[model samples]
Target: MWSGELLDLDAYLARIGYDGPVGEDGELRPDLGTLYAVHRAHTGAIAFENLDVLLGRPVELGVKALEDKLVHGRRGGYCYEQNSLLAAALERIGFEVSGRGARNRTRGDTLLAVTHAVLVVTVDGEPWLCDAGFGHQGPREPVPLARPGAEVVQGEWTYAVREEEEGILALSILREGIWRDLYAFSPQRYHPVDYVLLNHYSSTHPRSVFVARVIVQHPGDSVHHPVRRALVGRELNRLHADGRVERRSVEPDELLALLDREFGLRLSGRDAEELVRINRAGD
Candidate 1:
C-alpha cells in the first residue's frame, strides 16, 4: 500500500500520458477500463532499457528514486525499476497489487533463477498479469490470469498463460510460428528488498547480459503501428508486427543522436561520447 503523499498521482499520470477519468475525491478508481488504459499508456510512454547498468551506475528501487530517475529524469529502466514504479502507482490508485518473482527461460532450456519481476493485480476478485518491463516481447495490455491454453490476443501478438505446475504460471508468446516461453512465476509475493538483491546482481555481475551490452526499447507509435524500434549492442532493429525484422549496425558517431532522437533520451555530450567509445571497444 502507498500513501497519497508518497506517490504523487498527478505527476505519475502526467508522466505516463494518462488523462482518463478520476474520482471527484482526486483518486483513481480501479476498474478494468482504467487499468487497461493506464497499462497501455505506460508501456507506450516509458521504455525498457539498461543503459544505466551499462554505464556502471547504481540502480535504485525506492519509490522516490524511481520517480527521480525514470519519471522526472526522462530516462528508462529495466524490469525491477519499471515494475516497482508501476506497482506503486497502481497501489496508490486504489488497486490491489503484489510483486512476484519470475525466471527468464526465453534464451535457453535450463530453468534460470528468479531474476524477473511482475505485478499481480486483482480487480473485482479476479487476477491479471501486468508487465511493462519486457522490451519488445511483452504484451500491450493486461491479460487475465487464467489456466493453460488460455490465449489473449493483442494486435499482432498472441499470448498464453500456462499452468506449469500447481501455483506456477508460464507466460508464452507466439513468435515466428513457435510458442516461446517468456518467463515463469509462482503466486508467492515479493518485496522491495527482494528486488534490491536481484537488481544488485543484474547491474554488477560480470556475466549479466545487461552489463555486457547496450539495450534500449520503446513501443511503436500506436496500437496499429507495425514496427517497434530497439537498439541491441551495435545494431538497431525494427521489429514488425507481422514477424518481419529490419536491422542495421549503428555507427559510433551516430550513437548519441540516435539515442536522443529515436529513444527520447537526453544525456550529456561527454557521457554520450564515453558510451559510444566503450560500446565500440567492447565490440
Candidate 2:
C-alpha cells in the first residue's frame, strides 16, 4: 500500500549506508534484524526538517516524490515524508507495514489535531512502532508494540510505548528521570490520502508551526552518547545525553552553516539564498 515499486530501493539502501541484510539467497530479508538495521540507518543518515513548508513548497507524499526529494535530492523531511519513505522501503522488502495518524504530545497538555504520521511494521507475529520523523528527541529504532511500558534503549536515549486512554498508545521518553510523552496514536490505520489532507493543514494553515518557523532535527552524532539537536526558528537547542540543554541564537549569516555542519542538511545555492531570506524575515 506504500507504493514501494516506485521507489529506487537500491539508492535508498546506499543513501542510508546499509550494506548487508541480504539472506543466503541474495535477497533482502524481512526479519526483525533487517528492520532494526534499516530503521537505525535511515534515522542516522537522514534528518528531520520542515524546509519545504518554510520555503512555501508543497509537501509531497508519493513514494516516487519522496524518493526524488528525500533520498535522491539528499534532503531531510518532517513526519509524512520521513515515515512514508520508510514504509515504502520496508514494504518493498516484504514487511507488513501500516500507517497511523498521531497527535502531538510534546507541546504540553493542550490537545492538538492528528497531523503527525507514523508506521507500524509487523515482523514474525510481532508489531513494532517505527518512526523516522519527530525530530531529534525522537527514537532512532523501533520500540516494541507488544511490550507496553518496557524501555528500549537506543544509544544514549531510552524510549517506551505506554498504553493511553482508550485504545491509543503513547510513545514516551525518559528524560531527566521523567517519562515525558512524545506523541500518541490510536489503532486507527491511516492511508496516504488521509495524510494528504493532514499535510494540507500542516503545510498551509496559518496556525501550523511548520509554516511559521524553521525546524530541523537529528537524533545525534554519536552512538553511545548522542546529543540530540533541534533548530527552531532562530534558536538552536542541543539536548545532551544526560538531559542538559544548550541553546543558542542562530544568526541569519550562520544559519546555513549550522544546518550543514551540525544537522547534515545542505541545500542548493538558490534554496540556500531563499532560506537565508526566510531566516531574516523570521527575525
Query: How many residue pairs clash per model?
Result: 0, 0
Runs in model 2 with CA error above 4 Å?
A: none
Taken over the whole model, the C-alpha lDDT of each candidate is 0.84, 0.90
- What lDDT is obtained when candidate 1 is compared to the true structure? 0.84
Residue pairs with backbone overlap in model 1: none
Residue 95 shift from truth in candidate 1, angstroms: 0.6
Q: On residues 122-225, what C-alpha lDDT tens digit does candidate 2 reach at each position? A: 99999899999888888888889998989888887889999977989999999989989999999999998888899899999999999988999998654564
Per-residue lDDT value at 273 in model 1: 70
Candidate 1's TM-score reads 0.94
Supply the global lDDT for candidate 2: 0.90
| TM-score of each candidate structure, all chains considered together | 0.94, 0.97
